[model samples]
Each structure stands twice: as structure tokens, then as C-alpha cells.
Target: MSALLQLSKLIDALSERIGRWASWLVLAAVLISAINAVVRKAFNVSSNAYLEIQWYLFAAMFLLAAGYTMLRQEHVKIDVILHRFTKRTQIKIEIFGIVAFLFPLVLVVIDLSWPLVVKAWLTGEMSSNAGGLIRWPVYAMLPIGFALLGLQGISELIKRVAFLKGLIDDPTEKKLAKTAEEELAEAIRAAAEGAKK
Candidate 1:
């Protein structure tokens, strides 16, 4: 159990780091987009490569951060029904969903995508667009993203099992500090109460 928990922690840490780093790609994409626009408008110069690179960066950010999103429990959920359930029940449901849905879905995607990635790499596939980038790097993101998501799913399963066994706190509990929106709402409520007082 301890070993499993340690492995979970390691996977969580890796997902966190990858997410943080991948997030920067958003900024990079935006900057490149701005530069591309400026160059096209101001200098009457443009390159499909620049536009394609921006697209690549956006794809990379979304794909690479998927596992990180899951690790942080930020993925979309139907909370209306889920929140009504007991914590243990909720964890059990999650385990079932992970095993029954998530794992199979990711495995199918990875199985389907690996050959495309390999073919692209072997063929050195480049974009059909003139001055555009290679195809394999983007093709590779599919398998990489799904694999990371799968690993994170396993980590989440371990944590839930540990919680049920009295080895850890509620894994679904939000442990991070409040978001800026939450903090702002709290401040507004406090101010309103103070005015009434």
C-alpha cells in the first residue's frame, strides 16, 4: 500500500511538472501569433511556417496538460448528481468509471494513434502546406497525451483505494488554495457585511 501511494505521488508530481511547463506553450503560441500578424500586416510578409507553428504550440499545450488537468481534479464532471453521494460512494463510482470507461477509452486511442505516429516518424511526413512544419511531432502528441492521461488515471485510482483503506485523507478534497475568483467573492461578501454592520 505504501509503495502504491509512493508511486501515486510520483505520478502526480510528474503530471504537475508537465502541466506547468506545457502551460507556458500557451504564452509562446500567443506571442508567435502576434508576431505573425504584425509581420503580415506591417511588412506585407508572411510564412505558413509561423502560422503552423502557432497551431502546433496550441495543440501541444492542450495535449500535454490533459493529465495535469486530471491530476488536479479539474476535469469536467456532472457534480449535480455526484455531490449528492457519500465520499466513499463517490470514490467507488470514480474507481468504476476509471476502470470501465477511462482506461479502455485511452487504451483504444493510444492503440489507434501509435501506428500513425510511427508512420509519420518513419516517413518524415511534412505538412502539405508550403513552409509548414513536420507532421510527426503533432502526430506524436496523440499517444503521448493519452499515455499521460492513462498514467494519471492509475494514480487517481491508487489514491482512492488508499483513502478507502484509511491510508490517506479524502482524495477528492480540494487541498489547493482558493482561486482568485473565490477570493474576490469572499472579499465582496465581507465588504457588504461590514457596510450593514
Candidate 2:
């Protein structure tokens, strides 16, 4: 139990760092797209690299951010019916879902994607578009994304088990509301800081 908690913490910390980097990737992608549009419209010249860059950035952003999302418990759950259940029942369902569904799926994806990415790299796969930039890094995103997601799924399973064993209280009831409020406050603070700047 203690070992699982420690491993979960370490993974959470790593996910946080990855999530931050992913956020930067998203920001860079937006800026690049904007610049690309302007260049094409104003200067009547566009680089072939920008299209590939967008896909790479978007892929990295989604893949790297997945673990963070899982850690934050922000992933979608079809819980319209589950919400009416008792806490113990909810925990049981969660445990079942994690063990039976999530873990196996993640493991399969990570296992399959690893070889797929390696093959892409070995073959030097590129965009099918003629004279377009070939981005090998984007090919790497598949295994990396699923790998991080698998780590996160492990952490989540541990957490769910802990909750079921009565080691920790379940926070599902108010977790979303609290998270949303916190996010709103953060946005407000950022807006104020930008205004001051």
C-alpha cells in the first residue's frame, strides 16, 4: 500500500512536469498556426513545414497531457447513473472499471504502439504530401502517449483500491465542483496579473 502510494506520487510529479511542457506545446502550436495564416495571407508565401508542425504539436499536447488529466480526475466518466449509487457501490464500480477495462486497454495500446513507432522511425515514414516536411518526432507520440497513460492508469487503480479499502475517503461528490471553482479562481488571478502587466 505504502509502496503503491509512493509510486503514485512519483508518477504524479512526473505527469505534472509533462503536463506543463504539453501546455507550452499547445501555446506554441497556436502561435505557429496564427503566424502561418498571416504569412500565407499577407506575404503570399507559406512554409510546407507549418502543416507538419501543427500535427506534431497537437499530438504531443494531447498525448503528454493525458496523464495529467487522469491524475486530476478530469477524464470523462459516464456516471449519470452511477452518481445515484452509494459510496461503497461507486468504489466497487470504479475498481471494476479500472481493473477490467482501463488497465488492460492501456497495456495493449502501449505494447502495440511501441513497435509501431519504431517501425515508422526505421522506415523513415513521412507525410504523403509531396515536398512536405517529414516529422519523425510525431511518429514517436503514439507509444509515448499510451505509455504515460498506462502509468497514470496504474496510479488511478491504486487510488481507487485505497478508497475501496477505506484507507482514504472518496471525494467524487464535490471533486468536480471544487476543481472547477479553483480553475475559475486561477483564471481570474491570471487575468488580473495580465492587466497589471
Candidate 3:
């Protein structure tokens, strides 16, 4: 159990770093989009590469941050009703969800996508659109993202189980502080959480 917890901490650290890194991609995507638009309109020049790269960044941002999101417990959930349950019950439900849904889903996605990524890389596949970037980098994101997600899922499962065993604090409890960006995300989440009420 201690060993597993240590592994969980390591995974959590990695997820934290990756999440922070992924945050920069959001700015990068925005900047690229703005620049691409200006270049296309002002310079009367356009390339499929520019357009595809924007979506590629968006994809990378989403894919790479999944484990980080999971580590932060920032992923969506039925918080309103969940808050009503006892902590142990909630942890049990979380364990069940991780075991039954998260792990299998991650495995399936990686299994299906790995072949495509390998094929794309090996074949040196390029985008059909003129001047578009190679496809493998984007294709590779699927397995890499899901693998990270699976690792975080393992860490979360360990933490939840340990919590249930009275070995740790509640894994679902809110953190004490939030970054400015996280506060804004929370505001948006709070509004979207109208569904929860």
C-alpha cells in the first residue's frame, strides 16, 4: 500500500508538470490563430499547414492535459448529488467508476489508436491537404494521452482506496487555493453547474 501510494505521488507530480506545460499550449494556439488570420487577410496568403497546426495544438492541449486534469480532480462529475453522499460511499463510487469505466476505456482507446499512430509514423504519412503537416504527431497524441490518463487513473484509484481504509484524507476534498486561471475556470464551471442544481 505504501509503495502504491508512493507511485501515486510520482504520477501526480508528473501530471502536475504536464498540466502546467499544456496550459501554455492554450496561449500558443490563440497566438497562432491570431497570427494566421492576420497573415491570411493582410498578406493575402494562406496555407493548409497554418490551419491544421491550430487544430493540432488544440488537440495536443486537450490530449496531453487529460492526466493532469484527472490528477487535479478537475474533470466533470455529478458534484451536487455526489456531495450528498458519505465520503466513504463517494470514494467507493469513485473506485467503482475508475475500475469499471476509466481503465477499460483508456485501454480500448490506446489499443485502437496505437496501430494507426504506428502506421502513420512508419509510412511517413502526410496530410492530404497541400502544405499540411505530417499526421503522425497528431496521431500519436491519442495513445500518449490515454496512457497518461491511465496512469493517473491508477494513482487516483490508489488514493481513493487508501482514503477508504483510513490511511489518507478524503481524495475528493477541495484544495485550499486556486490560481487566477483556475478561479476563472471555476466561475465558468459554477455557471455550467446550473445543471447540477
Q: Which residue pairs show backbone clashes in model 1?
A: none
TM-score of each: 0.88, 0.83, 0.88
Model 1 TM: 0.88
Tell me which residue pairs clash in candidate 2.
none
In candidate 1, clashing pairs total 0
List model 1 lDDT by residue over 1-197, tens digit each: 99999999999999988986786686678789999999999999998999899888888988888998898788898988988999999999999999999999999999999999999999999999989899999988989999999999999999999999989999887668665346545756887899999
TM-score of 3: 0.88
TM-score of 2: 0.83
Off by over 4 Å in 3: 180-197
**Per-residue lDDT over 116-195 for candidate 2, one digit per residue giving the tens place of the 0 to 100 score:** 67777788877777656654678678778878888887877777787778776663433444453455457568878999
lDDT of 1 at 69: 85
